[model samples]
Target: MNKSEILNTIHELLKNIAPEMDPTLLGQEENIREALNIDSYDALQFIVALCEKLKIDIPEQDYGKTATIKSLLTYLEKKII
Candidate 1:
C-alpha cells in the first residue's frame, strides 16, 4: 500500500477503536494514546487491529515505533513496501 493508503487505514482502525476520537486532530508528532485519551488496552487493540488489517506483524518490542502518527506511518510504509 502507498503512504496515503496506509495512513487512511490507520485512521480507520483508530476510529473503529475509539469512535470519539478525531483522527485528523491527532498530531503526527504527539503520542496517540495521550492525544486521543485512549488507554493502554485501546492502544494495544489499535496495534492488534493494524496488524490484522494490514497483514503485518508488529512485535511487542517494536511497539514504541508506533507511538505517534508519523512514527507509525514511517513504520508501516517501510513494512508495507
Candidate 2:
C-alpha cells in the first residue's frame, strides 16, 4: 500500500479506537502521542488492534522509533508488506 493509504487506514483505526481523536489534524510529521493525546496504554491498544487487523506482530519498541505518521507507515510497509 502507498503512504496515504496506510496513513488513512491507521487514521481510521485511531478514530475507531478513540473517537475524540481528529484524524485530519494528524500530519505526517506529528507524533502519535502528542498529536492524538494518547498514552502508552492507548498506543499498546492500537498496536494490538493493528496486529489483529493487519496480521502483523509489531514489537513494542517499534512505536518508540515510529514517532510520526510517516515513520509508522514506513515501518508497517516494511514489516507488513
Number of the predicted model whose lDDT against the real structure is largest = 1
- Residue pairs with backbone overlap in model 1: none
Summarize candidate 1's per-residue lDDT along 1-81 as a digit string, tens digits. 899999899889888877987897787899888888889898999999999999999999999999999999998998989
Candidate 2 local Cα displacement, residue 5, angstroms: 3.2
Candidate 2 wrong stretches, greater than 4 Å: none
Against the hidden reference, what TM-scores do the models get? 0.95, 0.84
**Which 10 consecutive residues of model 2 have the lowest summed lDDT?**
59-68
lDDT of 2 by residue, 1-81 (tens): 676777778888899867976876877787877878888888888888888877888876676756788788888899766
lDDT of each: 0.90, 0.79
Residue 75, model 2: lDDT of 88
Residue-level lDDT for 19 in candidate 2: 94
Flag regions of model 1 displaced more than 4 Å.
none
Q: Kindly give the number of clashing pairs for every candidate.
A: 0, 0
TM-score of 2: 0.84
